[model samples]
Target: EDDVIWTVLDRVEISDDYTVIFHWKAPFPYGKAMIAISSLINYPYHIYGKWAEKVDPTVPVEEEPNKSLVASLKEFKPPRPITTGPFIFKTATTSELLLVKNPNYWAADTIENWETWFDGVLCRPHMADYNARLNNIMAGEVDLSFITVPKETVDSILTVPGMRFVAPPTASFFDLDFNYDKYPCNILEFRKALAYAIDRRAVQEVAAYYGFPIDKYATGLPKTFEEEWLSPEFLATLETYEYNPQKAEKILRGIGWSRGPDGNWRDAAGKQIKLAITTWGPYQDWVLAADNISHQLTKFGFPTELRPMPPELFYDAWDRGDFHLRVWYVGFWSTLSPWSGYQSTFGWDLTRPESLSWKGRRGLNPKDAVWAAFLVDRLGRAWKPEEQKLIVEKLAELHNKNVPLIPFVQKREYMFQLDGKRVTGWPDPDDPVWDGVTAQGPQCYTTLLVKGILKPVR
Candidate 1:
């Protein structure tokens, strides 16, 4: 009911003791995903509901200090844990956290093969000194490590006996997002030209920890999930881009950007076309990718600046849509929210008019923002599954034509290597059900594998 109230259900009626019926405002077939998230679970209304406040962006920032509805959500921490998971908190310190398996967990007697393998689990504090942690893992002091490493370091680690490496493609990715409000970037021809001029394959090679295999560069949606989500007719209409300098040059010429006396490209208004690419400095891959893009854009006769700042400053600048072109990643898979598919990240098409915010809290206004917003808003309010797909098809068409963001390389990833001396049966890359992504630990497709799946090789 919590999920449906925003878009689908009109009201929930208490039918009987064990049953509650949801009355939909419209006929909605997309409730399966919302239901899977337990969106109808009742919260403690008597205790916390009083703190709820309507958070509207129209409220002035100065006034928000006192008027925030979520101020209590952050300020208040309950006296004890209140969750129905398999673990129970026991003790904690600056250096460690200890938890014991909830032996009296609700399903203990009724569930099959549901006993926890560990009686207790201890987690060490997150270490900032990555080198020290890596060294300890090499010395067998730590059983596993998940921190990302350089290409050379990854190769060296693979040579360590009793340790194995696994790379899984996560939902995250790096991309080049264009700000529609920015000058030349607002032009479709310019955006498409940049897509063709930049050698994405080369950028992937320099940015990737592992060599950039073709499979690793398929950008945009996960091809594995595409067949399930994208309609065949819509998929067929999608436009694809590849590296072609001549095509880029032709497109730029058609858009009225021409070579000037300085031999650099210039707009009709005589301003030398310049682009700025920024990223957080802590992200080494993004810095390299930005630098690589700067060089490519320069070679294509567009002056470009690369700004690599601390994460805080970079994120603030990104949130303001202050750059002509920025290289970053935006995702829909993580949030799984229909509206956010377009409203998040650079928000190239988000716009607010007539007291209505087209996007989310940020109130981002991008020149290309509203058409996608209109379709997405309808998608949320849509009643029928077929109607929702029709809206998605239109959304896909806008995505291909707008070029708000260009997904260059898929975030093909590597894994946490467990010392073979400590554990085994960490499934390899091609075990079918679990590709080392999605599911975690010894569970494959949520089922515990035989021999515990992850056994102690020792």
Candidate 2:
């Protein structure tokens, strides 16, 4: 054997996940985080290996020489443990998943005392079949389900004897995404114009009112809940996006867009000042939003075209930057940085060369500033309290000004009902903190004491 020999590197356990840190005798950042998200069940992951061939930077899949590959395998199909209270993942299949009681589950002993008042707990996570799931719940086939049933359907479902309802807030939002990579929208005035023409209040009343209208909350974070991690100053800064169609029109008119004989706005070149926006087909709400916005934009001389694409094609066009505007949920998750994961939203990192259309989306090219702040925070570089506050405040202002994405609604008091007999240890719906319990709920983990179901018995 050669004088060089492989040696065990460093190892650290983050929560339950084991992370191996291999410090190669040589320099290579390539394999550092390579196996972070391996499909444990079906795929074998190579810790460190050589490329099969030379990789082409321009190509989607570079051909690397003798490269290591990680593949998902059938034998490793055990459900990975989760941390959402008492809902352990048991047997998972393509169509459905069954969750049995973890005999040694942390909650097992805790809930055994509750069994004196009820039966053992069981949880079944159904796939994306809403109608079938709802029918099962109604026919007494299944005990409970999570569904966004329509208003009329809910009235009928509530009539079922054992059924109860829990309305908790959800982390869903609606907003108009400007294709900054393209022309027209590449101009701030165009975005302001489009923003002016839409009637969000009406749209919320019609589309999002499931039963009630979206509450008027600033900062895009819902007022229905609170998070200590969010700074009060930053939350207070969210008021800049208040709806004002009058100002929207003034901004558009100031940009030299004028009304044409045909009753639409035309640019200086007499070309219609219109944009082609696409939304997912059958999303009646988005379609309605498009229509209302289009109608308003036309008044300001900006003609609008609303194109409905099939769900697949709709997302494809968005990723491709083919549309000028889009109406969808702009997800926001609060992490260490105020602008965590914003690179994909505001930065000009496109998969394809043609998609480099949103190049200048981030208003003042604040990438360097935003990213520097992120690194400083992560690296924990020493700085004065005022210095840190200054950096965070500047980052927040830049983020809001860029408007790479807009916020419409924050998570609200949305709830789901379950039959108590089949599903035990279900978080109480009336609990204010319970609304924030599930991942989808407004709160990280609804205030339920679900330590047992979240972690595996292992």
lDDT of 1 by residue, 208-286 (tens): 6552322222224443334445667667667766788898899878867789877789876778887898887766677
Whole-structure CA lDDT of model 2 = 0.49
The global C-alpha lDDT for each of the candidates, from Candidate 1 onward, is 0.60, 0.49
Tens-digit lDDT string for candidate 2 (217-299): 22222333224233676667553545676776677678786667786766667677657777766555566666666665655
Give the deviation of candidate 1 from the true structure as CA RMSD: 6.2
RMSD of 2: 8.8
Candidate 1, residue 237: the lDDT equals 68
**Model 2 regions lying over 4 Å from their true place:** 1-66, 70-144, 148-159, 170-172, 210-241, 280-311, 334-392, 424-427, 430-458
* Candidate achieving the largest lDDT: 1
